[model samples]
Target: MKKKHNDHFLFYSESKTKNRITINGQEKQHAIAVLRVEDGEHIQITDGQGNLFVCEVESVLKSSIECNIVESWSVKRITPDVTIALGLTDRAHFESAIESLTALGVKKIIPVIFEHCRKPWWDKWRRYEERFKLKMISSMKQCLYPYIPELVYPTILKEVLEEDKTHMIVADPNGSTLKSEIRDKQTPVTCIIGPPGGFSATEISEFNRTKVVYVKLTPNRLRTELAATVLCAQIIGHTL
Candidate 1:
């Protein structure tokens, strides 16, 4: 089994094992203001590229801090290549979907605007992307994963399906069982989740014509986020 490190770490630039390093810019502020790390304190550092460095703070300043690297190792993370394409919904449901997908180790998230979706909000998209990125990063840090999930801006559902020939599974409560529908699928799966009111009849027909298999989670209806999470969990659990 691989060894795990149990030490606090802050991101920094100019990190090298067995040598002095420096932390500056936003990272410096986060370390000083937020963490209040002091000199001679041991901390881990990463270049955000699968490298984790063990180091001790040498000095602290207003905008930067210097540290000496004691040890370094490459971090490996388990990230699924599955892509989750979800229809845009209310802010609460949208945010919940992002958080749940991140926790489930989804690699790519594509927010789709369906026929029944509310009018797009550019500000909400930007804010949600930023917040989702931070959440993914925090989750990755907590789990010691080296990669963060990617969040794509809202796009048209038709376009996404046309571009990717992935194993497509759409969640429909009245559809076939999930296990029977997606029992044996390879990687790079793409699952589509509709809005709260679910897809319209016309939309469902179009989806079926496009060869998107509809999978049912349970007999009881579920919220948009709940359906998305269940489908995602099934895909990840089965694939992994």
Candidate 2:
């Protein structure tokens, strides 16, 4: 096998018990037309579920490509798994935000609908589902991270408050710095952020009512997109 960019070669979205991996859609197009991979060539494949399947090209077709699985293994999930619950925002901006988070190794992204969030932001995901997904996929490829962050939908803040498995951290300018809160090193963290205009008073009261921790970075307020990523990146910084 010839060497290329070893950080990332290619990946399959699906990996099961079979000895071969079948790749279709844009992955196939890129492999055949762009990468110019020939038979017997080696490529990396991932199921986006912490598993990496090393494979060799068996055959290439117009619509898809086949590769014989050479070996397979799983990467351990990141410790202190972080989930970013993002309130809806501009489509392009949210896409960029999720893309950056996925690259940074976030385990999950929940597209939340807060009380002050714009009404149109609720179902906006349905419109750009494919494009947003592609953004994360491309981000994963660029970063050479095998596991793609799980994307969840327009959940309400109240509903998110119910998840007890994660140590929920809500973002507020009045809250403490990111470095200060996770000092206890809580695992399976879920950090929640408000919309462009910020969370409503009632929502804050509800958050306070819960056992959730309130945390912030600087006295200077950051945009929702930057804030969400900053919190996640900060978690990684502390964890590592």
Where in model 2 is the C-alpha error above 4 Å?
Answer: 1-7, 15-17, 119-121, 183-186
Global CA lDDT computed for model 2: 0.80
Model 1: per-residue Cα lDDT over 1-240, one tens digit each: 222224644464544535777888666887788877888877777764567777778889877788877788885544346788888878767777777776677777888888788756644666566666666655555655555567777888778779656578888766787666654534467888887667888777778778778888877888888888888888667655
The top-ranked prediction according to lDDT is 2
What stretches of model 1 exceed 4 Å from their correct place? 1-30, 33-35, 46-51, 66-80, 181-186
RMSD of each predicted structure: 4.5, 2.0
Which TM-score value belongs to model 2? 0.92
lDDT of 2 by residue, 111-183 (tens): 8887767657546567777787888888887777788898977788888888885488988877877776675
Question: Roughly what TM-score does model 1 have, to 2 decimal places?
Answer: 0.77
